[model samples]
Target: MKRVALLVLPALLLAGCAAKEAEPASAGLTVTGRYPLEYAEQFTIDECAGGYSLVTIGEERYLVVPEDAPLPTGLEQDLTILQQPIENIYLVSTSVMDPIISIGALDSIALSGTQADGWYLRQAREAMENGEIAYAGRYSTPDYETILNADCGLAIENTMIYHTPEVKEQLERFGIPVLVERSSYEENPLARMEWVKLYGLLLGKKEQAEQQFAEAEQRIAPLADQPSTGKTVAFFSITSNGLATVRKGNDYVARMIEMAGGDYVFADLTDNGNNLATVNLSLENFYAGAKDADVLIYNSTIEGEVDSLAALLEKCPLLADCKAVQQGNVWCTAQSLFQQSMELPDLILDMNRVFTQENPPESELKFLTKIQ
Candidate 1:
């Protein structure tokens, strides 16, 4: 793969700011080595002379500079620089919380964009209740006063931050680096989980992150050798307007279903490799595409789970005509399914079990529950 990087010129970066606009690595920069990677392709961690770690994510780049280390001279002035052992992070990206937590660096986060009650993770909720992590406001409306008071080192945001670019500008105006984590944009399910390695490096937990990712990789290794279950799955949930929100064929949901040895019934409904992972289908269209699917997995991460078959039918009466519905092969995802970003293998295993077994053990079901 082609290597693209940026320069982090300490001479040009404003004081207290960890990031700046990205520019290509100019004269006087040298590549040393890169942190080993497995499945993650969205970002890269490269080393330069004098121990400067250049992290490239798409067109943007960030350099992790060691404490008290003198800046590298002659590099481009546009790339951002983050001091090592970042602290007091104002995290607005909910998926990032899992990776940060997986490395035991939850203490490093000083503020959350999600409210106390908004978190599905117990550690996050407890952290907020115990005053360890406070709500600093949402991504669009951050509490600048609180963030400044906390001396926040970084502001981690999701793609939604793009909708409020002015807020990003304001954070930079205050010399606070705003990083938009794009793990959710990954097409591969494990690739999204692989971002844990990147967060591990940011929090100075490289070894732990590597171990976590390796273990997860090993756990799912056998899945590749498993024969296809010859079953088809339809993963979707009804939207507020009575439409079905479903994963596109190229989406991670479809990828996960395939890895679990099942076929995605809507595998041809791709978004032409765009960033969008899901597409909305009218009830009639969804039924036409998925009526004969052997399994129906209700994606409850967004709309909340239905407790029973009757509840699901009440929400979408058309499902009653589906083959999976008639055969009692319907299941609903747990509410925590999306929030458990670090548990990719476990989730894949859950899906695999559902496809291969007539009655998967209830005690072992982690991300899904069969509708009774």
Candidate 2:
């Protein structure tokens, strides 16, 4: 019996070694499809903490581990990691700037989107004022000379600029790599936030990006579960012709309306990909559709007291009959809400405060404001 047991043990060990040899390398690591921006290429793997290889997929990178390896604490197993350090970067997208700031790599930024009075940009306004960072211009209309002459190593752009191939080629000609982040176009806010890992990779601040995303996830998940007693809401931005362009179903604002515990009245509208579409509704149609809205929030483009909400409402009598207006529920959302550098978590909290019957607790009310 002792001789048989020793023979069995050797056979078992040999089988285990054979199975290990048969397994494929790079089995558990993540690999993304081709990047939308043509300048980005494939990545190489490098050793990470705990005997794992950090996989680079263009500017978007991730960490890969053996299937048997223990998952890292406080991180989702599927999350990607950016393992390289970036230098002298310029950002052309407002949406891309927020994640970079969230990951604490704002100091590495040499140039970025314009510094408006928005909260997120305001946080970095001092840096711009002090000449530590320069405003490259609008994401869609960047000053090419400023970009070419500046000591920029990389440029982070959004998918919106895909139409401008000539401009993209010019930037590439100067040896400046362009990385496109498509999170804003994603239907889910969490999915959009997940792309923060991409920014973490470019900035070589993967750990910081992971931590920030986890915090944002924790903050937003509870709001999804919060009980609501408020009426359904719909968001509209006024057009020059006095028509209200309702937010479409899959737009980012529509997602925020859901996160704030209000049903977006236009959730049934199917034109999902249009960022800004003219709904072309008459005052009769507008009142019939949004008359019951618990809150009426409008984008306040005015910076001074001369043209207040009162003055603006007077120009559009169609909003006069709104329940929100009758009951004084009308509020002004900052134009910054439309700005890309604005963090989404902050935006969600603002929506909650605007639509909720009871005010949010102090911590939850962090970035919100009334239209007064």
Candidate 3:
């Protein structure tokens, strides 16, 4: 038997049309006053004719074909729908979660992997509480079965799924499709924000996503021309082994630093497409590269305490004489950046505030409580 190719819907294309006007004539199937494809309706459409045609009514490019078309043998068929426009989604990554909530979908989320008290998580804490959203646990240990049983229409997972194929397979087995969000892997924060459209597509909220992204771009673009007279900054993630993993030149955080008018100390290193790159710096190498760093931002998993940085530096002797520490320019922010999925816009704004002197604080910043 000839194996039938599964009709694969390209996420980017679907994202573009999430909130588009309905087409009056979709082939012969008068789509009866088209509305955005609900979350469950989005995945119900299967490909036909060797995967050349699709059946759905949304912003995605789907084909209309005969209903009698043969489905590939042994392939599972299931139908799910987004009943409330995705008010309650389960977040497997925090990278883009804030951006999604910032765009007005906070109330729709049912649960999040990380706690609401974290810096980035605070962005949607009110909605989570008022809406009674649950916390299923950390990204590494989300309650997969509980999330599915909760009737979560969508699961926004990160590239880390590659590290756990069994989890991905299990979710698919349960008929809950996982959308791989790669914003955290994007080199530019603007590009990362552009991915907001992906969630919009899934939840029938593309227009909302586009408007939010446009406004964010407008706010950050002017900063590119703003002059900076301060010293450059460096951002690093401290591993369990106490190694300082420098973000590669192409990382989004590095780009955010540059956009906020601070030069990135590692902008010359190439990114390896993953959120991480191969720029392993030993104590001596780190001292040589960052000895004159004007500012240093370290990722801390602990909340409500500034002592983590001291402990980190005490363990790493090279950081003792760095200019940033010597001048008291070190700041300990949460490690939410590592897990961001759809929240890069707010992160960019936070960086802008921390790095730029001339920009006044927006009202939104008042509600953003730092983790310490």
Candidate 4:
């Protein structure tokens, strides 16, 4: 593998502010022996911390050290240790598939948690069909024997696996390291995108990751200073039992709405201590709060897609009184929105067009579907 020396430059942080450079770097392609992160606060690259990068995702922490680097001293047994050049990986996080594939390192993946038909990305689906990727059950109930037989060197899990601690332990018993990805915890959408840098570093594709993030940043640059449209948006989904689930105001989805020049309707629901992204609300309360919303985006990823405004109204008759519904300004997001993490920049641009235009050019929309 070719090694690329990449510098962590000023990147996007919360509040649309620029992140300060951690330290100055020498010119050219010399390995600095340090991995400096610009936006991922959940992890750190510290030499004093035993020359190992400490990554904290929710309550779980991991110590990631290079394969050739000396083991950090005084490390706790409770923490998972990940030695790098992570090949033969079992990627349990479906969202991370696009990022890994984008860097041309898809060959590094040996297993997937999602089935062929379940994948939204064409490359992932084809990989499974061609036997390049094998299905090893899901995050919670993995086929341990299949994983072991394949000799998976590392297992990259999402937060979903946090509920199944035994699974991690069982995998480790077989000598496979587990690293939980927490990019979803990022409050800023670009910060979440910047997580590709971490993957790049692990796969020795740091230069490609940096370039991808820079391009995504440039795509969102024009919307940074755009005047607010003052349009109020409600992004929600209906549960089978009639509860309305919405993203907390501080979550990345809500932040994306505000950044695109619209007001998130449920802004007051935000409580900093609450780390959960979605909150379930009574339909009555959902109606009371979102009735006057200027734009309504149905989170079809959770509630399932609706074919028409009539179908949506049938699911929640109370929504007819909502300003967005009355004005016929309702839209549904495709189920692929959550898995296609690489398209977030395009998603933001689509939202901006919807908030600012009376009739957006739907032909250019990537994730949103207008309710007829």
Candidate 5:
């Protein structure tokens, strides 16, 4: 269960290969193929949800015409294929935004689920002001009129959208194709990064998508050789009610800590047969288990901001006695890190820097900062 173990698949390994040259055949032969998607496990190309591996380029099926958009040339009457060069998209998943940005496909996004003020990425903010990206309401309660007005060709949703099947159905009924993204389910951090390539294919920026993954892998490659420091770290947040919620052992955050040369204190805390990736504990139990951890990383995304060590202690004075607090090893991640999937490499490097004492005690960090 080492992060290094999942790094074996090189970034280029998932690049869709060119269609094989077809041999000369009888005059009446008609050839077709499906697009190949090598790495992503969440969804398949051209294959039924259960039966087959990815299909190559020419064989794609399940074509749906957008509302008022004309069908592309040469499409089979009953076959399904998205009209190429997807120009207008409604992005419901904030995490998927970074991947779309990485491939230079931001211009293609016409609608977003996040409000302008909630956007942390400057590009997303600017797009909103420029009138290029419009608010289309959240996934739970989308504005159907705005979506139809945008002439949305596609809507990329996260798994959470499943809770609102009526919303998804409504979009489809309006001629927008809805694709549910499951990248968060990937246990391996690198595999999660591989999902960028899938977005690249959809955005028609496959080359840039492959390049982004390649660069991310190159940045993480050296960490595989770093010696393990055997330090133990705890990553969690205290809820408003004082309940402690921690990531399951196999979650990407835990794997990232292990890759950065620290041992996750709760590495055995996962529910074996269930798909839950986090568990809640009483404050008393949290104090007992994490009191001796060498480092403690606050999950700011869920707990809101903890500006200082004093502030954290004020929230739960018992934490003042934890080893991490006593040794000044407490840190907090930025809220944006939770939605910025493309920053995984930087996140791992930040963890390694803290775990190995490679930087000054008060140095500013990219994704995390020392709790003052």
Candidate 6:
């Protein structure tokens, strides 16, 4: 039987429409409207007549109150109230920190789930060095005292936090609300970047957030009409055991490649019901499928960058026979590309340049470096 594709409403296309008042919610307050998003599917913001916004992330709901706004009467006993002007936060999600920095709310963060050395954002690294943001331990083992002493208003964590429910429970037990950022779950690169709006809303920088998202949308405007470059590309990482880990056909990385006017070589790959975007296979199996690919892009976000065609061949000696390697058509992505959500469009443009051989000044290419 053929499968039916799911129809996901463009949370992006709905932006700027007049917000209509909806039915009265729990406290007899009607939802007046909401900040419309473009591609994001992981969360929503509904404005209420009582001057509060209801934020829903996954299955968790939060009531956001603007500074000096009165709390609505008779809210659900279990609902969390996130008063605005929030300060002293603990951020664990590395990708989330970029958007937080983009929204200019870095000062509000007092604790970090990632160590200073683990950060790729210069501002975050500098802040940690200056004692503005202290180490609060990783998600699996958070420092309770650091969080408590910092008076953490909220805990922004990644999906990995779910693996340690006790840590989340302990933070909540201490009155620190934990919000799991879900941008990584989005399958569309733009949808993932659209999370900037979510951060903007939370930090009271809605205008800046809107502008940031708009600018990124504009960056990919050419993609909406550009024809496919007809190039076949394979992107993967070599694991420690010599297995090749490649993205699923419908994964966001594959989608990004398609948007860049190229066809993903492994367009039919899937691991049934695993919910994993990537799957590992023997190097021989990978070679059988992609040996003739026109371009090979190494994902350095996982195993780090590899220099020289000879060095890559050392990792997978079989790849030395692949068409791309033989033709010297290989590239490597920057280690920080995955964490900086705003740069995915730029990455697409970089791929386009390689596929089309648009030799702009070398300085124009940001994320990808040629493998000599």
Question: What are the lDDT scores of the predictions, listed in order?
Answer: 0.83, 0.57, 0.56, 0.78, 0.73, 0.81
Query: In terms of TM-score, which candidate is stronger, 1 or 6?
Result: 1
Each candidate's TM vs. the true structure? Answer: 0.92, 0.69, 0.66, 0.86, 0.81, 0.91
lDDT tens readout by residue for model 4, 165-277: 99987887777778788888888888788888878777778799988888988998999989899999999999999899999887899989988999998987876576678
Worst 10 residues of 1 by lDDT: 1-10
At residue 325, what lDDT does model 4 achieve? 91
RMSD score of candidate 2 (Å): 12.6
Cα RMSD of all models vs. native, in order, equals 5.6, 12.6, 8.7, 7.1, 9.0, 7.7
lDDT of 5 by residue, 5-55 (tens): 001111112122222333211122112334454445554443221121232
List residue ranges in candidate 1 displaced over 4 A. 1-29, 272-274
Cand. 1 TM to true fold = 0.92
User: What C-alpha lDDT does candidate 3 achieve relative to the native structure?
Assistant: 0.56
Which digits, one per residue and each the tens of the lDDT, describe model 6 over residues 94-179? Answer: 88887778778888788998889888779999999999999989899999987787778888898888888998888877878788
**Model 2 over residues 65-101: C-alpha lDDT tens digits?**
3334653333333334322344566776766666777
Better of 3 and 4 by lDDT: 4
User: What is the TM-score (0 to 1) of candidate 6?
Assistant: 0.91
Q: What TM value does model 3 have?
A: 0.66
- Please give the lDDT score at residue 275 for candidate 6: 64
How many residue pairs clash in all the candidates, one count each?
A: 0, 3, 22, 0, 13, 3
Count of clashing pairs, candidate 4: 0
What is the TM-score ranking, best to worst?
1, 6, 4, 5, 2, 3
Ranking by lDDT: 1, 6, 4, 5, 2, 3
Residue lDDT tens for model 3, 1-372: 111122433222222122233332322222233332222222323322232223342322333322234322221132122222343467776665666665677655677776657535665676556657788766567687667666765566776777887876666566555555555555676766666655555445668987876776777666667777465887765555655668788777787787767888878877555445436667677677788988777655422224544675665767888887776666665455444544455655666676654333445442122321
Better of 4 and 6 by lDDT: 6
Q: Which ranges of candidate 5 are over 4 A from the true structure?
A: 1-40, 45-81, 272-274, 358-364
Q: Alpha-carbon error at 57 in model 5, in Å?
A: 17
Cα lDDT for residue 218, candidate 6? 90
